[model samples]
Target: MSNVSVCFSWQIFTMESCVLIILVAMPGVWGGAWGVTFGDLCALKGTSVVMNCSYDYPSGYSVTNVGWSRPHYAAASGKWRLFFLSRLPTPPVHFEYVGDYNGNCNLKIHDVQRTDEGNYYFSFVTTLDRYTSTTPARLSVKELTAIVRPSTVAEGDDVSLTCVLGCPARTAVVWFRDGQRVLKPVFQARREDAGRYYCAVLGQETVRSASVVLNVQYAPKNVTLSVSPPRGVVQGSSVAFACASDANPPVTPTAYSLYKDGQFVSAGQSHTVLGVQPSHSGLYRCQAWNNVSWRGVDLMNSTEIRLDVQYGPTYISVSLEPQHAVEGSRVNLTCSAVANPAADNYTWWHKRTDSASSSPGPMLWAGSGRVLTLPAVEASHAGLYVCRARNSVGEMSSAEMLLTMSRGKRGSQPHLIIAGVGGFLSVTLVIALLWYRKQRTHAERKPAVFGSGLGVRGSSSPATGDQLDAVYANVGTSQWSPPLATAAQDAASRSQRSARHEHELPTSDEAEVTYSTVTIQPRNPSFPPRTNNSRAPQKCGIQCLTLMAVDIHGRKRDTLV
Candidate 1:
């Protein structure tokens, strides 16, 4: 058996090793090049590495089919796939040449990548390996592409450019940035990846290539932008805008860079107010860049935005219904902040507490702030009212206006106490008079009916009966006392008692009463006692009763002496 082999160090480019050949004669001992060495190669990730294999077969042992594959490292097997004469090379397999079955075979990689490292085998349909099989060919790879770095990037401004490598990491890849060899990463990413980014590649055995271009994408991209006051930004006035961008390095470390009209005005600032108004205004924009990208992107773009200065509503107004209303009268109030373009809106809040309070508390006037149409004004609405006006730019308030709600004119006057009393007295008097008249008539109309043996009589005399009851009952009896009975013959001594009473009744206007005995002493003796007994003696209301004899005044006699 005879074999040829070459050896070299892992990472270093070394001179070719001396070849050695050993010859041996024995049965089943196959002789050929046991080891064909392919040195390590540098290439970018996601690219292919090829191991070209060629061989001469003995005349008696004709060739069958040839195949290439990574039998070991199952995980890397896909990355190191197979190329055969009969089938298309599997995934991770490059392009295959079918003509290899008769003798010629070449493997081509469509897209190369990292991780496709390890041993590869070639096979022929034979008795040994179902015809033929080779040990393996060892190949190594070195990364060829350059690293990229970016420096400080603003939210809306492009950060400076920085890069590690700009060249393809193959054939001794060369790095160049801004037209210079860059051994280390640059500080900032360039726009267009910069006409600046490129690399020159040298051939493994032939001529070198001119620098190639590298297009990079970095963090923080830009979006729409707008302003609250779109007219023209003024000095000492707040200006606002919106910014957005897409980035992997994170837009967090980014800051806003504001350019006024065209000149750099501020940085790391969004809500900006140029305290001092500049004289000009024009084009404006910003870009974002970071070490994450080889080229910078825009975080927020500058739309058409200008700044202008203006004033807001000054004095406000408040009106009360029925301009001349009385206290506690319902007052409709309209408090408005009159200014340019009116107000944005109005909000009304009472100076005091509301229904949530514990007492008869105050409440906010209802309506859209400016007009508070109090359905009904109460005493509570009597106070100072303040009108406030505000815009995106500023806010102002009006002087307080005093609002007085009155309880209108008195509904009706209070009735007099005397009138109330007089009414009650008149009612009482009427009742009294009616009762008196009724009693007098009733007594006069009644026919006397003596009990048992007594008689009944109707006399026209003013006092047919004792007139006592007429005068007494005139005032209406408080207590009606029955007259003392004279003679009640129907009963006992009571009959005489009743009789005396009965005879004592007055016959004429003046009644002659014969007491047991009596004598009269006139105020003037000249005027003798009236001899006409029926002539109604005495004066008014006098009563006369006819009797047997009378003795003298103040005395009762047994006979008419």
Candidate 2:
């Protein structure tokens, strides 16, 4: 034992009789019996447990003499100390904080302690047959009795505390909440539910109960995620979805993911958008998370999208003007094809010629397949040309054009001018020759007088032939001039010569100056007629005839004719 003790003799106490006399235990040679009747009581921190104690007394003992003590087992002097006691008016000083002695002297310490286990002694006297009965009390103080409440409960359900009581013989059950006595059904304290609770009982010395954690679990039913703009959104637009459930906490940061075209677009804020172009169209779904412990769940099962793009025309053409071209002239070949989309490039083709074959054949210029243009004229340039235009969308070609050209003539203009001048001079010379010929024709006489008018001379007829010598002598050199003035002029041009015929044989007739001496024509047939010319002869065979007359100077005429 750990405490001081006092001894009391029990032979003086009677069972049935009692008086109000005090009998204190004195210092004794041997200490009072202190034993631990109930083993150490056990309990959790927030609950309660109990220990049991009891004693016997004879009749006729004074009831006021009972004294209960709980002593420390570590105390020297061999007894347990009185931490709790019970008595009547004016009981022992050690019984101040102990239990009452009026009826059942049971001890109940709220929130029992582990160090409370020790020896407990009861010293009392009771009145029965009117004798003074003194007795020694034996007490064994132990740890508080205890139990453990069940630790868990599901939410929205009845909660029960499975209280396991230690020291079953001495432990009693009492309900306490926040250090106050709470009335409940026999051993069970159930109120729809509670978070943490305790059980207490009064027994020998201590009160204790069990402490347990009441945990609850529940799931929110009908959980769902709402998608804003729920109607499948247009491609390239936006959508939102939020996961909502009836849970204890609704504002937990959850994940909302969306998928499309075999790709994940977003993982939060529910909606997924596929905006405007055709490529953006696809199927979509979403997964969400919240204040629940399950893995990500699909908020949306399936969705679809269709996006369309509208466009205008393409491949444009512009009509070229001037459908005909000359080989020498530079043709303005404008080939234009127009559409909503501009044409990117242009090509030119030739319309086949060769009508006889009935099959179109390419001309040389046409085979060039270039914009129809000819810098200079050539026979090969004659062909038809067409321009083709194209863009990404489509292609178009322009109408063909025919090119014609005249080959230039080859001549020297300077030679023509010289020839024209020489012809004019030749015509003037011929006109002058004709005028001179006409003038000469007018001067000639008629054909009846051809070869007439020779000079005639007459001399006085001297006796024929007798006076011939004398007559010839007397007619000395009287000359006859013939009409040969032009011939005479020809001889005079050589030298100054006398116009005289040879006078050798003309002595007789020549001295007489006789014109009859000239030979007359004997009809002139034997003369060969001057070898007649075949061409049309000149009409005036004898041209410019002149007559010779004698000029007597202002005197009587001498008849010489």
Model 2: runs farther than 4 Å from truth? 1-63, 72-105, 108-119, 125-163, 166-256, 259-264, 268-285, 289-561
| RMSD vs true structure, all candidates | 22.3, 28.2
Tens-digit per-residue lDDT, 1-561, candidate 1:
021221121111122211211112133455533222233333343445454555555444545445565543235444533333234334633544433644544454434443455455554432221222345655443333333332333223333323223223414545566666666333344443443444444332111223334444455555334555676454456656544455545454246565666676656435444452333334455544444533343344545455444445656666666675454344566666644445786645455433466553344543456666654466665565666667654567666556654464532223346667889999999999999999867754533222222111243333322322222111111122222132222133433554565467555422332322123233454653433223322331111221122223322111110
Over 382-495, each residue of candidate 2 has an lDDT whose tens digit, in order, gives 556666665554566666666555454312345557777888888988888988888646533211111122233443332222221121111112333333343334333322
For candidate 2, the TM-score is: 0.26
Best model per TM-score: 1
Residue runs of model 1 more than 4 Å from their true location after superposition? 1-45, 48-50, 73-89, 92-95, 98-105, 125-135, 141-143, 148-227, 230-561
Per-prediction TM-score to the true structure, in the order listed: 0.28, 0.26
lDDT of 2: 0.39
Who wins the lDDT comparison?
Answer: 1
Error of 1 at 49 (Å): 5.2
Q: Which ten residues in a row are the worst by lDDT in model 2?
A: 552-561
Number of clashes recorded per candidate: 74, 75
Report how far residue 544 has shifted in candidate 2, in Å.
94
lDDT of 1 at 534: 35
